[model samples]
Target: MLKPSIDSLMTKINSKYTLVTVSAYRARRLRENPELFQKSEKSTSVNYVGMALEEIDSEKLTYEVRDKDETTS
Candidate 1:
């Protein structure tokens, strides 16, 4: 079973696609730099991906939604 349940992660990120994308990107960052971890709570997992999920669960990690129109400008 995943430490941070999918249900919990959904609350932090309303869209499933956005959640996966955000976590994946964060996981990649952790892989490159082991010091980018933002979790300060009792960790439930040691892996980079798990760490990213935990950050989301603890509300330590968040994402902003930028309008597509704004990006192409």
Candidate 2:
């Protein structure tokens, strides 16, 4: 079974799309710069994507939504 359930991830994120985007972004970063983020002691995942999900589940990874109007400038 997945360590972080879908329900748990849903609570941290707004939607499944957002969750995928955030996790993908974080996973990319993890791949590029493995030193930037800290891994939890309890994490047993070997791949970056899994690590990303675990981080998100633990609230270590977070995202901010920007309004479209704010980017118009």
Candidate 3:
């Protein structure tokens, strides 16, 4: 079973789209550099996608909300 529930993950992230975006980004990073992030032995059962979700669920990985005006400038 997935350690972090969907509800929990959703709470950390603003929207489902954002969750997917963040998780995908983190998963890609993990694939490129496995040594950068540390995972518990239990995480071995799941693949990188799950690992990424776990990181977000645990608060190990976080995202910042940027104002639209900042990006538009």
Candidate 4:
């Protein structure tokens, strides 16, 4: 089973696309530097992606969606 279920992740991030984007970004960071993980001791996940999901479920990691115009630099 997934450590952090998709349903729980959806509560933290509204859209599936955004959730995937944010988790993937965070997972990459975790893979590059495992030190970025805050729930290492508590998290049951053994991989970076699972850890990223756990972080989202625990509200430890978050993403901000900027205005559309702001992204159009």
- On TM-score, the leading prediction is 2
Tens digits of per-residue lDDT for model 3 on 2-60? 56788899889979999999999988998898775657655643577888988888788
Instruction: Give lDDT tens digits, candidate 4, residues 1-73.
Output: 6657788789899999999899999999999999889975678988988889999999999888799999898
- lDDT score, candidate 4, position 69: 100
Per-model TM values vs. the true structure: 0.87, 0.88, 0.78, 0.88
Among all windows of ten consecutive residues in candidate 3, which has the lowest summed lDDT? 37-46
- Candidate 3: list runs displaced more than 4 Å: 41-45, 69-73
Instruction: Give per-residue lDDT, candidate 1, residue 17.
Output: 91
By TM-score, is 1 or 3 better? 1
Which tens-of-lDDT digit does each residue in 1-73 have in candidate 1? 7678999999899989998899999999999998989767588678988988899899988889899998996
The lDDT of each candidate is: 0.88, 0.88, 0.82, 0.88
Model 3 steric clash total: 0
Give me the displacement of residue 3 in model 2, in angstroms: 1.5
TM-score winner, 1 or 2: 2
Q: RMSD per prediction, one decimal? A: 1.3, 1.2, 2.0, 1.4
Q: Which run of 10 residues does model 2 get worst, by summed lDDT? A: 35-44
lDDT of 1: 0.88
Residue 51 in model 4: shift from native, Å?
Answer: 0.6
User: Stretches of candidate 4 above 4 Å error?
Assistant: none
lDDT of 2 at 35: 83
Against the hidden true structure, what lDDT does model 2 obtain? 0.88
How good is model 2 by TM-score?
0.88
Candidate 2 segments whose C-alpha is farther than 4 A from its true place: none
